[model samples]
Target: MNVRHQIKDYIEAQPELKRSDMQELHGIILGIMPDCKLWFLDGRDESGKVVSNPNIGYGVQALKYADGKTREFYQIGMSANTTGISVYIMGIKDKKYLAEKYGKRIGQASVTGYCIKFRALRNIDVDILVDAMRYGVEKTRV
Candidate 1:
């Protein structure tokens, strides 16, 4: 299926509450970066083992490895985990930035190096999450 279809399927497969939350977040991210590149990773390794939760991704960022090889990945990603939803803001140089800048102000969520995880939408400030996403996109502009 197409990227949009794949994303829809992923979101719709979630439980009722998570499905709604993911759908809403999908709309908000699209509104923020309408022209961004969309990605659907099925969360499998090359060997076909499921390594992570399926993700709906937005924007583009090239990541360089130690050997000078690079791979392009999403600037922002959203996934539904066993406990809750995770919003990943990739491409930030400073690992501590997210936790330091938005940890206290973003309500009841775990603000990690590159991820903002929460049990539900009501538990965190969606606006601040949006801001962090935008910042991540800007920082990774190519």
Candidate 2:
């Protein structure tokens, strides 16, 4: 199916609580970036083994490699894991920025370099999350 369909199916396949949070998060991200690229990764390698949690991605960022090559990827991503939901704000170069800037204000969540993981949407500050994600988008503008 298409990217949007795949994203909907993935979010709808989660458990009730998770499904609800995922849907809300998806809508919020879309509102933040209304006219941007969308991606759905099944989290499998070419061999088709499950390498990671399947995720829905939004926006586009070009990643430059040390080898002088560049690849297009999502600027933000979200996934449902066994314990909670993970909202990934990719394309940040500094590994410590997220934690240092928003760790304390983001509510009850794990703020990593390029990821802000929380158990549920209600458990975190949505405004802070949006600020962090908006920062990522601006920082990765290309």
Candidate 3:
């Protein structure tokens, strides 16, 4: 329910994580975007109880992208895995189009027309991602 609990539960469910792993993941997240707004989402089952799924993850509001009319920016989604971490770009309207365009250049983990998933944080070109986010926010500003 709470962010910390959700994070803790997510970590614990993995079962194979070492203390150093946790620290490394946390540090990596913080290091990636120091000013990002972190939110803990409760992954729930069909009955609404908290559940675990590698697909479900946390989000960081990276930047507010907007133009004079549209106001939607990119919020980065991140998750921890047994081997490494995953980062995804969120808040896109044409996920399908973007996926098709960037899928080859940047790996597409998922594309439900909302979130553009990717691999580990280091795998992505951060400057390009940030610029895209900023442009999205600025382009969509109302």
Q: Provide the TM-score for each candidate, comma-separated.
A: 0.97, 0.97, 0.45
**Model 3 alpha-carbon drift over 4 Å, by segment:** 1-9, 15-29, 45-47, 50-74, 79-88, 107-112, 116-142
lDDT of 3 by residue, 1-142 (tens): 7656666666666545433444455555555556554565454677988674333233333344475354323355545644454445565566575456554565424434444444444555545444444444443333
For model 1 the local lDDT of residue 92 reads 90
Q: What's the lDDT for candidate 3? A: 0.49
Model 1 error, position 21 (Å): 0.6
**Residue-pair clashes per candidate:** 0, 0, 16
Which residue segments of model 2 deviate by more than 4 Å? none
On a 0 to 1 TM-score scale, where does candidate 3 land against the true structure?
0.45
- Residue pairs in collision within model 1: none
Residue 33 miss distance in model 2 (angstroms) = 0.3
